[model samples]
Structures are given as C-alpha cells and as structure tokens.
Target: TVFGLVVKDYDGDGKKDIVLGGNFYQSKPEAGIYDASYGLLLKGDGKGGFTAVKPQVSGIVIKGAVRDIKEIKAGNNKLLIVAKNNDKTEVLSFK
Candidate 1:
C-alpha cells in the first residue's frame, strides 16, 4: 500500500497553509529503491478551504521520513517547527 498524508490548519482557513509529507509505495518494480516525497506549503483562505502553494517534493535529502511536526515560538511573528525525519532531526522556521 502507498503511504501518504494530508495536513491543514485546524483553525478556520480556506487554504491548507501547512506542510505535509510521508512515504509512498513504488509503482514500478525496483529493488531497494525508495523515493522520498516533497514537503508542501499550503495557504489558508480563512474561510474553510485551502490551496496548495507548494507541491510535495523533497527539498532536502534527509536520513528518514518526517513522522511528526511540532510548532514552537521562535520570535515575534516567527515560528519554528521541529520534525523527526526518520532517525534524524530537523528544524523549520517561518515568519
């Protein structure tokens, strides 16, 4: 089975305005070959819908898949996201 996911803002927003990624099953027969999906940036409309601002494609080559996302306050008008990429760790920030 193909493993994938979708993410969205819990608050009211027409745009998704969030990042989502996961593992996916291979369509063609390949041995020991794994493809990583890209991260997406969503935009919320504040109405109740979302649009994909960015498509899913890996920007960074990490060790593993991003299992979870945690948001933290980085600074005024800025936020940080701590994610677990397989056995490795990564940090993403936004302003």
Candidate 2:
C-alpha cells in the first residue's frame, strides 16, 4: 500500500521527480498496516521519464518497514521526507 506520494524536483534537475513510500508489493494481512520496507526515490530526466534509484546502492539507506511518510521542505528549502519506521521515525533528505 502507498502511504503517501509526491512529485517534485528531487534532484534540482528542473524536472518533476517522484517520491513514494510504502511496503513491498504484497497482499498479506499487514500489507499497509505493518509492512515498512518500501520507500522509493525516483529521479526524473529533463524529458518526462523517471528512474527508480535505490538509496542503499547509492550509499544511502532509508529502511522500510515504515509506517507513514510525508514530503517536506528542509530549512534550506530542499526536498526531504519524514517516515515512520517500525518503532521509530526518521528523516531522509533528497540528493
């Protein structure tokens, strides 16, 4: 299930990027209730295309098993996300 979704310029590339947070695709009992292992950072190209980029592989980690997520503006006006994990919540800044 998707807890939240927002399209913004995540990479400052002047194109609309996508930020999605939810659990892995499944239809289990806790699908959207407890599964917190799905958050995606999709970069956008100058055109109208987007690419899913895993933060961990890129040296970043935004663990799932997350409960909720929201997009916000950091103090510097950059795109950021606040997510609720299993027992705690964390913030992730878009790069």
Candidate 3:
C-alpha cells in the first residue's frame, strides 16, 4: 500500500534510490488496522537492482498514512518533502 514515493540519488553514488511510505488505518473492526509498514528505503545498485535499508540506517522513518512525496529546492540545497496524514511534514536533505 504505497501511497507516496520518491526516487533520487540520496547517497551520491550515481545511482537512483527509492523511498516508500504508506499505511492503511481505515478498516472494519474484525479486519483491524493495517500498519505493518514502517516505511522503506531502497538503495539502488545502478544495475536496476535495489537493496533494502533499515530506517535507523537510512534516517527516513514515516508514521501514519503517507499522502505525497515531492522534491523541492531551497536556494542552493535540494530537499525531499514528505506529507503524511495527521502528521508533521518531513524534509530530507542529502549531501
């Protein structure tokens, strides 16, 4: 249930990486809430392959349902912005 995602070279390795965020909170009582995902960071290998990186390592932790992901520029720096439901927007910058 990926509602938001962004792709970029976050590690400066000349390869594209991925950031995924999503969660399903609306469900019947019997079905329960679907919140297994805690966000995902996929590091690309430049050969069309990717490796999963943990949140602690990647520094991209998303909670609640993700709505959108966008890239923005702030003067000389570029940043990744994350929007979530009932949560504060997050910003990520890479060097």
Query: lDDT per prediction?
Result: 0.47, 0.63, 0.83
Residue range 6-95, candidate 1, lDDT tens digits: 354433343445556554343356554354554555566766666655333323232345565655555643333435434555665454
C-alpha lDDT of candidate 2 relative to the true structure: 0.63
User: Best candidate, lDDT-wise?
Assistant: 3
- The most accurate candidate by TM-score is 3
Error of 2 at 93 (Å): 2.0
**Which ranges of candidate 2 are over 4 A from the true structure?**
24-38, 56-60, 77-79
Note the clash tally of each candidate: 16, 5, 0
Mind giving the per-residue lDDT tens digits that candidate 2 earns over 1-95?
56666788867768887777665434566544445545677788868778888866433355565556666776776545556545467666654
Model 3 — which ten-residue stretch has the worst lDDT? 73-82
In model 3, how many backbone clashes occur?
0
Between candidates 2 and 3, the one scoring higher on lDDT is: 3
The TM-score of candidate 2 is 0.62
Ranking by lDDT: 3, 2, 1
Displacement of residue 71 (Cα, Å) in model 2 is 2.8
